[model samples]
Target: MHYDVFNGDADGILALLQLRLAEPKETALITGVKRDISLVKQVDVGQATSVTVLDVSMEKNTGALSELLANDIPVFYVDHHRTGDIPESPLLTSLVNTSPDVCTSLLVNDYLKGKHHLWAIAAAYGDNLKKVAARHCVLNGVGSQLSTQLEALGTYVNYNGYGRTTDDLHYHPADLYQKLLAYEHPENLFSNKSSLFYDLESAYEQDMNMAQTAEVLFDNNICKVVCLDDAPWSRRVSGVFGNELANQSPDKAHGVLTRNLDHSYTVSVRAPLNNKQGADEVCIRFPTGGGRAGAAGINALPEEQIETFISVLQNYYD
Candidate 1:
């Protein structure tokens, strides 16, 4: 059996889409809410012959990856996140780039020699690499109108990946991928009125409005922190809100903290857009935290330590 393990966000989903579209495959898909990065451990190596991992940090899955290699389950890993030390194993085919400007979809685009460049551009847009996606659009002679459409589609798709669980999402990432696989071109998806685009757009608008009015927990020259109440909307919109905040203030880091049912916080941290570093370092300081340099997250940050988190972020960015 072949297993397809990937992050649930647009970048991860589209990365796998490009590959499967290029070469059709029969595989069991493994994924979860966007923050679920330790997916490799879910794969049963005894029942798997090969695995393709995408858009997830290798650092978080090193142990499981090593076990997969030990069991001789060949693994193909591609991502744009912090990867500590890639293991030296013939069973592993790894392609990782921590460049702030590149995303997994773009990496897959290069791997596939740009056979699916349009989808790659959309994924880049969804991942908030707007400039990078625009360059690709211009290079391909894609007009501004179509570029804007792609950006919206990518953003909506990426937004659906947020949430503490699949229930909070309009479509499970696996189901979303299957629905998207039928369309060879992204334009077809936009033209289809029945596509999940409409649903995601509606939900995104409602959630984003709520997030916009969330209370500002902390604000300073170096960092700003916003807190949202414990609700489905908060879980759904926190990641995108963090991205929006970072974009709005390119020089200042932003943290979007959503209250969890247990009173802990689900934190989404974005380093200053102008200087996309230290986010991963700061996040990894917590137990349930890990991500790339530009954007990292902590799944369940203690409420009491919220102040400590702010101090660390302030100190690092200051």
Candidate 2:
């Protein structure tokens, strides 16, 4: 038996789809929404001859990954996360391509010899690598209008994964993947969801309006920080707010800290688009938190450190 594990977001699902479409095979799928990437540990090696892991961090899953390799089951890891020490086991084939400019789908496209280049652009768009997506679009004769649509679809689908729970999203990403896989072009997929997009755009507009009213806390001039305590709107709009703020003020680094049910807060960080340097250095201070220089997150922060965190952000600004 073979099993496929992937992040349940549009990028991960599209990467898996490209892989499957290039080479169809029977396999059990292991996936969950954006937050569930760490759940790859639950997969048992005893039940499969081979496993393909996509868009999940092997560094974070080092223990489970090492155990799987020790069991002599072949494992293939394809991802773009911050990596630690990777083992030399012959049973494991890891593709750790952590380029700030590209994404996992583009790496998979390279692996597949670019046989599905169009899909690769869609994945890149979904992952928010707009420049790369646009370059690929031009390379493949994808018109500007079509590229824009794919960009919107990709961004919206990725946004769907930011909900605090499945109930808050338009559809669970796995459910959305079913609809997505039914079409070849991302434009076609967007066509199927025109009504959904209209509704989502309106909701997004209202949400942004509310977010603009959030109190701003400047830890540093370069970094803009905001805190929302136990607000339902905060949980729903946290990620989107980060994106919107980053775009609206491209010169400043942005962070949004929202209280989770456990009283700790979740942190979303975004570096200015043009200069995404040094974001990772700040996040590595916490366990189970790391990402690209431009975008990163911390799963949880002790409530007590909230003030200290703000101070640190001020230091980053200086």
Candidate 3:
């Protein structure tokens, strides 16, 4: 038996689709929303001959990953997340590529020789790699209209992963993927299915609501910081707030912090649209975070350091 594990976001799903299409196989898929990164621990390794992990990082789930590898199950990982000690065994075939220039979807597209360029474009949009996505679309001969539609679907599904819990999403990402699978092209998706557009629009509205209600913990000429309490809505809203705020204040950076159920905080930090190079510096203070010049995040931060976290933001402004 084979099990395919991936992140439940647009990039992860698209990457898996590219792989499955390349090598059609009977396999069980393991995934959940963006927050459910620790899903590997729950899988019964003994039952599978191989595991293909996409989007999710092996470093983050080292214990479970080690367990799977120890059971003699071959593991194939494809991601652009941070890396740790990757086991050196013939049983493991890993393609862990972590770089600021590309996303997991694009990586897989390159791995598969660009046969599924449209799906790769969608994945790039979902990850906010607009320039890269546009360049690829142009090269692939995708017209402007189709490109925009694909971008919208990618953005919508990416936005749906924000809320702190599943309830905040207008539609669970898995269901959204099912809807996307129904159409062969983005034109058919938007033209033939009013329901898909409506659902995406509804999700966008709720995402805006969360953004509007975000508590202003810090406000300055160059930056704004907001904190959200743990809730399905907040989780789903976290990344969306950063994306929306960046658009709203092109000259100012936007930072969103979400409290997890365990009293920790997961931060989504974006540099000013005009100066996206500072995002990496902003996340450097956190032990478990790093990213490119324009965007970064700390996957988890202890609650007790809330004060310190705020202080770090102040440093960015100063």
Candidate 4:
């Protein structure tokens, strides 16, 4: 059977959604929390069929991907994250762009020739491509009211993807994908009051409320760092909270750290909204860290390095 591997975040889910909506497929789905990007290895290579991988970094999955190519299994890979060095093989079809302005969903939208751009716009908003999503909305003649709805929907879907594990998430990414598959377009889900949007909106609001009380570890002219204690809510909100902070203070780089059980931390970093670059550079310096220019994260950071993280961010932004 075919395998569909993707990041659980909004960009990955929506990218595959758009592709399947355009060309229906029956495949085994493999995904996990947003930070769980090394997914290509999960595919049952013995099953023997084509594979479609989305959103997750090519660099992290390079080994598994290389094996797939060696097996002569055709693979369609699309993403906007850092891809170290692409392997050479005619069996691989890769559309990897590291541009901060784009996300996997937007790439799929381009591939589909805008057949399902509304979903793409929402995905863009969820991926924090505010300007790009807004431009797409305007181009489609979507008014302010609809644009706001799309943005909220996108953000909520994205928020549901974060968590230390699926137990902390409202819906497993696979379930969430199935729920969204019912809608041919986002507008349908928006009009249906019973859609997952309402549940996610309420949960997102509660999580953000708790995040508001999280202690600020550091603040300065060029950077701000906040740390949340070990809790399910902290794990769920850390990434989105950083996005909100970046929007609130466009000139300051932001970091949100959620203390893990071992006292290590899961970190999310956002470059200044006014200057959407270098976040990946800052995060890549740490172990278990990698992402795009505008946004990046570290899966686990030793507690002792917290000060170093703050200093690196400050020095980079300063």
Candidate 5:
């Protein structure tokens, strides 16, 4: 059995899509909500002959990766996140790059020699590599109108990956992947008025409106913090909202904190878009927090520590 493990977000899903489209394969797909990065541990090595991991941080899955190698199950790992000391094992074929501008799908595209270049652009857009995606579109002679469509499609796919669990999402990542497989070109997915794109666009607009109304907890020249009350929409839109905030205020870091059912918070932190540094460093200081330097998150930040989080952000960016 071949197990395919990936992050549920657009970058991960599209990375796998490019590979499967290039070389059709049968594999048991393993994925969860976007925040669920420890997916490698779920693979039963005893029942797996080979595994392909995508977009998930190597640092988070190092133990499980080591175990898979120990069991002699060959693993192909690819990602664009913090990877601490990749293990030396013949069973492991790893392609890990932490460059802020590159995403896993782009890496896979390079590996596949751009056979699925359009899909790669979509993934780049989804991962918020706007300039990179634009360059690809321009080089391919994709007009601005088509570029907008691709960007919207990518953003919708990425937005669907947020949420506390699959139930909170518009479509489970697996189902979305299968639906997307029907269309070879992403523009085909948006051909109909009643398409998935329309559905996701509507939902995204609604959730983002609600998120925008979140109370500002703190705002300074260097940093801003906003708090959202516990709700399905809040949880679903937190990460995307943080991105929007960062883009809107490129010089200032932004933090979006969504209150969890347990009164703690799920925090999304974006470093200043101009600098794109220290977000992971600040987030890692808290328990259940880890991500790339440009953008990071804290899964369950205590309510009491919210002040400290704000302080850290201000100090770091100051």
Candidate 6:
């Protein structure tokens, strides 16, 4: 049996989307809410013929990945995050680039020789690689109007992936991936009136409206922190809201912390747009935290350490 494992976020979903479109395959899809990144171990290697992993950090999944490689499971791994130390095995094919300007889908696009360039652009935008996405369009001769639409598609699809669990999402990531595979091109998704695009777009607007009222925990020239109440909307909008704040400020690092059920916090950190290098560093300092340099997050943070987190963010960015 072939198993396709990926992060639920746009980069992971779209990366796999491009590959499946280019090389049609029948496989079981494994995914969860955006924070659920330790997916490699969840796959039952007993019934697996091959495995494909995308967008998830290898650092966190190293143990499971090593086991799969030891068993000769034949894994194709692709990502744009901190990879601890990739195993050296003939059965393993790794395409990981930790470059701040790229996303997993962009790397997949290169692998496919641009078979799905438009979809790749959307993933780039979703990852908040806005400058790179724009430059990609300019380099490829794509017009401005189409670029804007791709941005919206990326944002909406990306917005759907955030949540405490799949229950909070408008569409499960697997369902959303299946829904999107129907469209040969990203633009076709926009043309269809009854597409998931419209639903996601509407939902994005609603959650973002709620995020506007988040309480500012701290703000300075180096970094800023905003707190959201314990609600579904808070869980659904925390990461994307961080992206929005990063884009708006560009000069200051941003953190969006949503209260969790245990009085802990779910945190999303975006390094300054002008200097996207410290997010992963800052987040990895906390337990249950890991991500790429441009944007990283803590799945759960203690309420007591909230102040410490803020101090770390400022210190890292300063």
RMSD of 2: 2.4
Give the TM-scores of the predictions, in the order they appear.
0.98, 0.89, 0.84, 0.99, 0.98, 0.99
How many clashes in candidate 6? 0
Q: What's model 6's overall lDDT?
A: 0.91
What are the lDDT figures for the candidates, one per model?
0.92, 0.74, 0.76, 0.92, 0.90, 0.91
Error of 2 at 243 (Å): 2.3
lDDT of 2 by residue, 1-318 (tens): 888888766678778888887888888887775656675577877787888988887767788888888889888889887768887799988887777776788889989998877778877876767788999988889987888877766666666666566676666666666666666555565566565555556665676677777777664557788976666556667766787777778777888988888988888787776676656667767774676666777778788877776666556655
Candidate 1 residue pairs in backbone clash? none
**Cα lDDT for residue 174, model 4?**
94
Give the higher-TM-score candidate: 2 or 3: 2
lDDT of 4 by residue, 1-318 (tens): 999998898998899899999999898999999999989999878895999999999989999999988888999999999899999999989998888899999999999999999889999999999999999998889899889998998898889889999999999999999889989988888888887898899999999999999899999889999999888888888888999999999999999999888889999999998999999999999988899999999999999999999999999989
Misplaced by over 4 Å in model 6 are none
Q: TM-score for candidate 6, please give it.
A: 0.99
Task: Report the lDDT tens digits of candidate 1 across residue range 1-318.
Answer: 999999999999999999999989999999999998889999998899999999988988999999999999999999999898899999999888899899999999999999999999999999988889999999999998899988988898899999888999889999999999998999987787877787788889988988879899899889999999988888888888898998899999999999988999999999998998889889989998888888998999999999999998999999
Cα error, candidate 6, residue 109 (Å): 0.6
Clashes of 4: 0
- Residue 272 in candidate 4, Cα distance off native in Å: 0.7
Candidate 2, residue 127: the lDDT equals 73
**Count of backbone clashes for each model?**
0, 1, 10, 0, 0, 0
Is 3 or 6 the stronger prediction by lDDT?
A: 6
- For model 2 the local lDDT of residue 67 reads 82
